[model samples]
Target: MTASTAQQVVYDPYSAAFKDDPWPVYRRLRDEAPVYHSQKWGFWALSRFEDVRAAARDHETYLSFEGIDIDDTAKDMSAPGFLPDIDNPRHDQLRRIVQRTFVPRTIAKLEDDVRRVVTGLVDRFADTGTADIAQDLAWPIPYAVFFDVLGLPTTGSDREDLVRWSHGLKDREDDDPRLTPVAWDALHDTKDYLAHVLTERRAHPREDLLSTLVTAEVDDHDGVPYAPARIDRDSEIVGLAFVLFLAGVESTSALLSTAFRELARHPEQAAGLVADPAGIPAAVEEALRFDAPLQVAGRTTTRDVELHGVTIPAGERVFLVYGSANRDERQFDDPDRFDVTRPPQRHMSFSEGLHGCLGAPLARLEARVALEVALPRLGRFEISGPLTRYRSTPNMRVLDSLPVSFTPSGRTS
Candidate 1:
């Protein structure tokens, strides 16, 4: 349904229908209500590619210090503003400390490890004839890489707990009031785990990112000239770890699942990659654009602002829908169609600003390596059953299960 100024449509983030497929709603918002206001949720949204990108770039106007989610932004979680919740100066300082670690060069070094993880996952179901790629491959690969990258042990139930915490952090359920509390518990547990790990690593430093965080020093910004101070406080370190967990595991996992689902739907696209593995990079970009892993990003307006002839009042929460913006007709030629070989079009999938995804290089690297290894092995997998999407969180687009049937080569098994 095309929206027009004559008819105003309500956008409720809590609704399950909206969670299922937001493309239609996004299109209407872009065409009709460029600056859509949701009376039910009490928030404004910018769905157009240009509007969303502009809001993301102008961080001063669309501040992150107010928290990044409409629901969580209103609550007092009793925690210091983390990466997604903090603004510049502080954000730049904290991000720089970890930025060097996620550069392409650093991520490229993990190619072998990622391949190994992918190989191991595929081997488990290679002879079974059917596999839920989301569970069997996409899900485990990221957590495995995340644990390895942070120099944490890939043993016991710790990794499982991390996954749980990651999910809880993003899950949003308006029906069940307990959902938010449970999510907070998960967040706290993760922070506590990181604090414990920081203590152990600090006493016995190692060649890992966590250890680097333990020993790194930065300006205190206390006073003139600034005194040097360790940045590894339990509070600060947990925030850093939390952000990494979300980016490294949750979003990357979704990207892989979404990419494979698209591949199963479109054999020709997969054929191109199978024919030449070098084209895997382009496929990855297309996947990121087609079905962005991280869908909605939250921000708050610093003051009254006029957009698309509508004036938004001061201090109103806004959602910059990356999922919608990526599909905006103004941006891509055929927005809805998934074309791997589409011409170069910069997408807002990873966002575009100082607060843009820091783990983008690592995400692309992991997805590319996973595709390079799995696509050739699967030969031509077809969707054997219905795809189940996780609906607890409207912010993320992830599959709980994606069952596919493939003639297993049994080569690695």
Candidate 2:
């Protein structure tokens, strides 16, 4: 083990001040204590760009089985590990199944579907002159896309149920009731709801992710599989769905909100996309890196590790502040400035290496088409009301509400 550092670092991710905007504190931590140790959380932290990138990249040393939520309880830990956390052979098998549904070829088939959905939201709001972007537009896109891909209904109470549950999971410790063990109740219910979906897919397997997983086979890493044709675990299926639904809704919606906010704040940038639709994809990438939906992620140390000469003991959690790292001057030039043409630099927004976001391409495509389709059609829109930022979890930077004014294209010209 490397020598332990003298300075104790305290940056509770749950701290009230840190939630609203943590850049200043993160910047200080990067320079002051690159390997800050927090006894409050009983873990070590890596805030600098180099440290965070390295931690995320070295999945062998810093594994993600710990789960993303800083406040995860025994219940959460007890739940089956999802795509984001599972390691190796099993991960590869499950991923192959999940990927079948979300790959570009499959998603491209839904371009018309996405465009139709986008048009409906914009059209409804165009006549009304008001709509909450996060609620009405941003939040529903992914759910619509997900369910449509799965051959499920995109309407009814499940939409509302999922939305509330989604927000509940992201709230600040005090604000988001889901922060407590009480959230497990909701998690359990969500599990039940998703379980039904699994059963439905099993009974009537379709050409979707669940159906594919229902039929896919896994071989043991030790080659101990009784049969390669065995069915996947049902509990794992439901657990992965729960995670997928949440991941699909939360991060994409957050990114959408951020993208909309950026456009509203910088009409010129919005105009740039509107003028040349080709630029929207690049714009989305910059927005992703600039104000990432997932601003922080980490790994739990499997063994004692040395970070910048500071020893992080085994079995301790290490915070990898990608929100800070994304803006690191050392890694990105003019790191704070938001430019649409960022040349697709490898930012830690989706993280790196083994556990990086599996839905990256899908997310990027969603963002690109969303902004391209909506911004031009919704004539002149701006944040007409007080913006309500989503509750900050250690893992996400999201806006809860973005009330806006939007005029339709025909009505404008």
Instruction: Give one digit per residue, the lDDT tens place, for model 1 in 213-304.
Output: 66765543532221123333246665676566556787888999989999999988898899998888888999999888878888888899
Clashing pairs in 1: none
Over the stretch 1-413, how does candidate 2's per-residue lDDT look in tens digits? 22243253346676666777677777767777778877656767787788788888888888767766556532253356377767665567766657667767866777787888877777777677677889888877887887666545567788667656655554446323135544555566666776776666767888766566555555435443221232233377666666676677677888889888888888888887888889888888788778878776656888999766777888887878888888888888987788886777877888888777777777776777788778876656789998877764556777779998877556753
Specify the poorest-scoring 10-residue window by lDDT in model 2: 225-234
Instruction: Candidate 1: list runs displaced more than 4 Å.
Output: 1-7, 73-78, 174-178, 220-234, 410-413
TM-score of each: 0.91, 0.88
Q: Report every candidate's CA lDDT.
A: 0.78, 0.71
lDDT for model 2 comes to 0.71
For candidate 1, give the lDDT of residue 137: 88
